[model samples]
Target chain A: MALVFLVLFVAFLLVLLGRRKPALVVGLIGLLFAALMFRYHLTDQVRLSL
Target chain B: MQLLNAVAAMVLYSVVLGAFWFQFGDSELPCPLCLLIRIGMLATAFGLTLNAFWEPRPLHYGIALLGAVLGAAISLRQVALHVVPGTGSFGGAVFGFHLYTWALIVFSVMILAIGAVICFQRQFEAQQSPAPSLVRFAGRFVVILGLLLCLANVIAVTAECGVTGCPDNPTGYLIS
Candidate 1:
């Protein structure tokens, strides 16, 4: 999770540096990590009861 | 102008999330389809966040496209879940169909519309001169991110759904 934040921060910095393409690339990668985390949350547990 | 659209998207997504929370409270777990929508929402939020920081136009476009595609996919799934009883649990069946699903569909359309506007507006503005290098770079980045995120999300959902003997509880008990 922290790594995701770190990546986002770096991506933002890249954007600030006028590296818009890389920033977007890194942000998408970060989102992928987030999705994986969400998947882990969903599958690792046995059942989700409301 | 871009910020306005991004803010609007964020507002719409917040409503979607709020509706989901309201219908199911905090306890119920999301199904595979529902999880996909959540991923969509997160992507939109991330896009909005980047937009808020004035990252670049490409990032904005990417966010809008990602949100739109995810929204469309989930809405279609919700429609299927509504039409087909046991195809997949649509979560608590709030508002005739899953509220989040409906929200995702609506949000997706909005994002797509916003994306179209952004693209056309840029083209119109650039008629006389070349698009600024940074702006063009941003656009490419966004389009690529949108495509990749959508693909990754679909793969994740597919893998989860393919597993045998998945739990049947409507409100996902996994979170609890």
Candidate 2:
């Protein structure tokens, strides 16, 4: 998940260097990925606790 | 405004360095989520450093906002993991607060700072034209620090996590 965030952030940076709108779009996508990762993490924690 | 970005970048780098201190000096490998938070900090610092080099834009602040929000969420989750009455907190206390608690405070402050940037957009714009001489000098330092921290993170993560990736609860470096 950390690697995923790093890749997405790098992509966001690259896209940002070229275009604004696209960069924003990429950032939103990154946010979605983060949300998904967090959800998975939370679920895993729950399973562990159970 | 640019000065603000430079200073913010420096401060973020210091926090990351503190994380590195724990990782290398203390031989405590960070959990996967902790690493994610560190990456988030780097991303935020990178955005601020970028803003220091160029005119402040909504996009730059937007990136920082995303990083802070993501990092805060992860930190909050880490805090939640130990919130139960009987469970002991992870890691040793730093200044009477756990590292994750410090992260939450830092992220909260970062959110407010980003909000300030949004609120004072006009001020940032007004100051952009001349591109203060101080920014020219400080910007380089921010860039160097940002890169150094990023490199250190990459090296440390690779050493600990390896190609297989980090364990959920990392105990130490996994370099075999």
Candidate 3:
């Protein structure tokens, strides 16, 4: 979802400004957002493909 | 140098932004696979953004490479899905190719390009020293652009899918 990138972008910005710790935290949040998005997409659709 | 990497990411973001605009303009709805491709693009962009800001390292390039590989895989999967003789393609096609096909090409190119760029050890040294004003400006500009794009997608996706998750085949914005 866009939230994933939104979180990661903020994290990237944090690192650019010389904030490493916060960037890591934000990056993890982004990953979490991505995981949720993936779960939702897969579970909702539940398609089978080769 | 680092500026070029940032610019590369900028270009990638621009392409996705164009697609986002086209989606709204043409009333095309992105399916779940399409959404994954976008995420893959963002993941790759994230790695490149890191390289642009910090000192260029093999690890950073590795991150970018990983994202590209995964994205390419997803793109390929979608292409396979619609490649059947009778099955129709998703949304719309651009220049006779679906967006997934383009995504595969972009990620493939990014993989090669990153490898070529990583071979140059000189650029890595450039970032250790104080970056020039232009590089700094470019870095800020690219990140700001990314922020804005993310904001737009977040709002747009929310309006499109709401909290229930995106539909397999979306037709229009859903707020209920």
Best by TM-score: 3
Instruction: In model 3, state the lDDT of residue B134.
Output: 85
Off by over 4 Å in 3: A28-50, B126-128
Off by over 4 Å in 1: A1-23, A30-50, B23-26, B85-89, B93-95, B120-176
| Candidate 1 lDDT tens digits, B1-176 | 43454455456545545645753475454454555455555556556545544433564667656755655655564565456556655456556656655665566666766666666545223245554565555434543343443444334333444323224344333222
TM-score computed on alpha carbons, candidate 2: 0.82
Worst 10-residue lDDT window for candidate 1 chain B reads: B167-176
Q: Provide i-RMS per model in Å.
A: 11.2, 3.9, 2.6
Order the candidate numbers by TM-score, best to worst: 3, 2, 1
Please compute and give the TM-score of the first chain of candidate 2 against the native first chain.
Answer: 0.61
Q: Which candidate order results from sorting by lDDT in descending order?
A: 3, 2, 1
> Best by DockQ, which number?
3
User: Poorest 10 consecutive residues of model 3 chain B by lDDT?
Assistant: B122-131
lDDT of each: 0.52, 0.72, 0.74
Residue B166, model 1, lDDT: 29
Candidate 2 TM-score on chain B: 0.92
Q: In model 2, where do residues sit more than 4 Å from their true spots? A: A1-37, A45-50, B124-129
Compute fnat per model. 0.02, 0.08, 0.35
DockQ of every candidate: 0.07, 0.24, 0.41
Residue-by-residue lDDT tens digits, candidate 2, B1-176: 77888899888888888988887688777887787778678767766766776657877887888888888989988888888889987776799998889999999999998887778747455552566678777876776666556556666777787755567877666664
